[model samples]
Target: MLKAQQSTEMERLLMAWILLQNFDVQVSRFVDLISFLMADCRYQQMMKWIGNIHETLSQLFIDASPLDHTTCRMAL
Candidate 1:
């Protein structure tokens, strides 16, 4: 039989950071929060968190770059 998997603290933190944006979190705070998540020893969760961060930043840049958000204030 297969056992159910549980989330580690790092994964939980990453999930929380992802959800925080829905609650109107500041972008800089969200980036800072990722640093806390990266401290965990769980390799898989850490990689997932890295991917999530990369994806989010990539999309934000994609939107901001075309909109002339060089100051980044309007995009965020």
Candidate 2:
């Protein structure tokens, strides 16, 4: 009977270890996914800022007179 009890305990311990390993893998995957999403979000925000700057510059060029354009070119 004692041997049977020991065997059962060993089985339970093995099962628990396996479950913990699986949990660790799942947590690692979740962390990786979150990191990828955060990077993508940052990339999208940078693109939006670039678009806004381009639009503003386009408008500036359109509205500027010839003298202003000459001045701008010289400044550049």
Candidate 3:
């Protein structure tokens, strides 16, 4: 049951990231989602998934266009 709840929260966080235009909020929301997921004892085994998302976010900044580079880096 707890796993289901955490999964839902994580989904909501990702949706919030996608729907929201503010990069700062997206990063913060993801971080909070990761923190919450980490708090779950059973999900500690899934830490790699959280790490992957963080890595993806980092890559997203690097892949962004030059004009958005400063904006993305500043948000990170």
Candidate 4:
């Protein structure tokens, strides 16, 4: 999206909120997939890719909550 145009503040915020709302189930499924793939020949490389995805998701949560810092500070 950034390549075409920057998101409006509201759009970005909404994106983050949506991402967070679904993240619990999303990450759980990702973990299961990763575990299932662990015996593959590419296991080590797959772990690194999954780790990067996780970091990106974490950043999304951060980006979403900065405007209302207190909201993000609460335990998820």
Model 4 TM-score (2 dp): 0.33
Each prediction's TM-score versus the true structure: 0.42, 0.33, 0.38, 0.33
Clashing pairs in 3: none
Ranking by TM-score: 1, 3, 2, 4
Off by over 4 Å in 2: 1-42, 69-76
Question: Which predicted model would earn the best lDDT?
Answer: 3
For model 3, how does the per-residue alpha-carbon lDDT over 3-41 read when each residue is reduced to its tens digit? Answer: 798888677556645633455454555556556655542
lDDT of 2 at 14: 57
Q: Rate the local accuracy (lDDT) of all candidates.
A: 0.55, 0.45, 0.59, 0.47
For model 1, how does the per-residue alpha-carbon lDDT over 1-75 read when each residue is reduced to its tens digit?
122223456466657556554534555555555655555435786668666765666467556644354534444
lDDT of 4 by residue, 1-76 (tens): 7433333433543544465565444544544443443333233664576556556545555566435534434544
- In model 3, where is the ten-residue run with the lowest total lDDT? 19-28
| Higher-scoring candidate on lDDT, 2 or 4 | 4
Q: CA lDDT of 13 in candidate 3?
A: 58
Give me the displacement of residue 18 in model 1, in angstroms: 5.1
The count of residue-pair clashes in candidate 3 stands at: 0
| lDDT of model 3, residue 35 | 61
